[model samples]
Target: MRIAFVSFETVYHRDTETSQRFRTVCELFAARGHDVNCYCAGFWAGEESAFERNGVTYHAVSSGTEARSSFLLRLPFVLATASPDVIHASAQPSSQVLAASWGSTLARAPLVLEWYGDDGVSDTRWSRLATGRPGRIVTPSELVGTWVREIGADGDIVDTVPNPIDCERIHRVEPGEAVDVIYARRLDEGANLESLLLGLAELRGRDWSAKVVGDGPERETYERLARDLRIEDRVTFVGDLDLEERIAAYRGAHVFAQTADHCVFPTEMLWALAAGCVGIVEYHANSSAHELVEGWDRGFRTTSEDELAEAILAAGDLEHREYDEAFAEYDRSAVADRYLELYRTLQEAQGLL
Candidate 1:
């Protein structure tokens, strides 16, 4: 099948979790001998107007020093070049999904809009209108799915597919390199990494190490807070590292601690599972963290500060979760298999199969 994956975000932004997820999906399809093309807004150096990377084709769209003012003008060229069977979109009603809608109409392709983040759905009112157009909407979790349902999308047209991870990259190593708990997020204040520091401070006598990976607007604040907590020596703010280092940290460490903003973000949840760490996720309203923790007995969840502290204290037993090899059946290969089935379903439903 000929598939065009569209994102308005520049390829410079492709290094992020959401973009990497899409890239994994594209590679999945490509590995199976499907024709795949990626359309991204170009902001990279000397990438041409458009080019193909690996087996996948990338069409570049121009922009000003600011936002994409030329998207309407550029849409015609992209759609004409990549006449595709499916236009699977990422994020909300940005130029990405809008281009998907336009491409579906002109190129006669089915549309699949994948929602990675909750901000557009949770904050903006305009998100309601442009999102209503796509042929199908896909979300990574029941939390986002429930929101889409509330927005009154056709129940059958919208479905849930967990975010894809490159399992090979996170494939496990030896017994372990260190006895530390890992917290890897953008380290922003609202993400509540400070509270994590406080909790760790409260447990300094436990003789545990904390490997904090990531840099953000709150790095200096978190560093100062760690120092004040007198746990700064134990906590290593290893600055920001690449994806490989992050995954290696997850593997080398004994546990995963994510006190995400109420755990509404699903990327960390998926990463925790993929990293083979027995995770302790934060619970809050609009959170699917508990959903990831449910029934698996492979992970734990806590919301309160006391509960988080307790989890931190007990994070040493990362192996007791009885590593679910059964769940490994749902890894990238399994997910890609499912997506191929979905694509074939689309083809057969349209009698093109």
Candidate 2:
């Protein structure tokens, strides 16, 4: 399969979750022997129009990351020249989707938009028009899929393909020292750590300890909150950790609590669940974290701090596990297969397969 990805700014240009997700899937597709080419503003050093790394080829639509109008104008012609079987694109800077649409039409390829919905993308006239242009829209969660539908995209064309997890790594890493509770995510304004802190404060008399496994601008604020709550002694603020360290923490922890106020997909929570932690998610209007725990036996969904506290306590009764096989479907390979399936379906529909 020849796959073309269109994103003016990639993970190299900006290290946002949406960018990382796009690059991860692109590399995964390339690893599976698909011919993958990414069209973006070049981020590599030197004066090269194209660069190859990690089994993927990246073509520069612009020499550097500047002048959005120039990138938009060049992208369509560049994509048409590549002539890939399918065109995958990021949904930010929605005008790019429109440009990709023109390119897909010229290249006689199907266009699939990956919409993470976490970047606070505002709806402009161009974005509203672009929403309806993609042949298919892929979101990480149904919550995001629904958002796409509301913003003029056809619901019939929207599908949810979750973020992938490295299941083998989870199985390989040994559990770290055991703890009663765990919370992991960047401590940004949306972290909502207070929910978990308040919940834990209620259970102060209980013999429980927690580890916060991330760092961000709001880390000090959360640390101060823990101190004020007087649970600082029990909660350890172990800033951001590498994947292995995080997996170890998840494996050793009995319960993993997610209280973020905004989340397109709960990637960390999924990791913890795969590590065998009983999941406790606080429901929020903008977050899809609760979607992961809805019907799972070892998962609990709470609407309030009291319910969150109760769920944490209830998780104590579940047997501790070092790894869970139920999340195998979300393994990186499996998720890549989902994208491949979608690509084939679209290609066949267009008589390109």
Candidate 3:
């Protein structure tokens, strides 16, 4: 099948979790003999044109200026050139969605809109998209599947496919001698790194140390907070590790801390769990991190900073148990196959089979 991915940002624009997931999906499809094309804005380097990587092709519609207008104008032409059998785009109202809908009709290809449970987007917007062009909606979780229906999308068109993890690549290794607690996220304001820092500070007298990974706008702020907490010497800010270093940190850590307020079973946490690291997630009103630890002995859900601190202090006592079965379905290959099934079903429904 020829697939065209329509998005405003590419993995290069921001190596974010969502963009990387899209890249993985395209790579998986391309590996299985599908002709995949990505249409999006140019990289930060501002190269506006078409390029190819692995088996997938990339079409950059805009440099770095006037993103929405540029993308809306160039989308139809790019779609005409690529002419894919399926056009997959986000349900969020962006230039990509509008253009993809137009292109799907112009090219007569089925449109598959993905709902990632972005709370910022209104239900009315999703309802409008669902009423158009006869298509399907793909969600990464059952929560999102229900969300689409509540927003007036048909249940018959919704597919619940969870986000994939590279399980094989993130398998467990024997941990190091020192009890290490790890936290990985885009150290931004919303990340709630302050909670984790406070928790670590409370345990300054303890034997365990921490490694804070990833970098963002609030890195300096977080560093200041760590200093103010007087645990700066115990907590090391290892800003953004490459793939190997990331895996190594997870594998070596005795515990992994998650304090983000709005993530849903984040891929990094899943990786840590798969690598045999004990998981402790903090509960926030709008956060779904607790849902991942529900009914699991290897994972703990805490409701406050004090609880998080207590859980971290108890990390050494928690026995190392393999929870690999819980995350097996999240493997990248497994997710790709699920998406393939969705694509095939859509194609068959449209009589393209």
Overall lDDT per candidate, in order of appearance: 0.69, 0.91, 0.75
Candidate 1 contains a number of clashing pairs equal to: 0
213-322 in candidate 1: lDDT tens per residue?
88899889989988888998888889887766676666666667777664444565466566667777777676666777777665778877678788866766546321
Better of 1 and 3 by TM-score: 1
- For each candidate in turn, the TM-score is 0.82, 0.97, 0.81
Pitting candidate 1 against candidate 2, the one with the higher lDDT is 2
Which residue pairs in candidate 3 have backbone atoms (N, alpha carbon, C) closer than 3 angstroms, thus clashing?
A: 214-240
- Please write out the lDDT profile of model 2 over residues 59-119, one tens digit for every residue: 9898877778889999999889888999999998888999999999999999999998887
Ranking by TM-score: 2, 1, 3
RMSD of each: 3.5, 1.2, 3.7
Q: After superposition, how far is residue 99 of candidate 2 from its true place, in Å?
A: 1.4
Best model number under lDDT: 2
Better of 1 and 2 by TM-score: 2
lDDT of 1 at 144: 77
The number of clashing residue pairs in each candidate reads 0, 0, 1
Q: Write the per-residue lDDT of candidate 3 for residues 1-353, one digit (tens) a residue.
A: 88988877767776655666677777888888888888877763444477888887887777643577888787877786777889988654444676788888788788888667645335566455653534777776655666567767778887777677776666544434344788998887788999888888778887778888899999999999988988888888989887667777777778889999877447788777877788899987656666677898778888788898888767678875433567787787888888888878888988988
> Candidate 3: misplaced stretches above 4 Å?
13-17, 41-49, 60-83, 92-95, 117-119, 123-127, 130-134, 142-150, 171-177, 201-206, 227-230, 313-315, 321-325
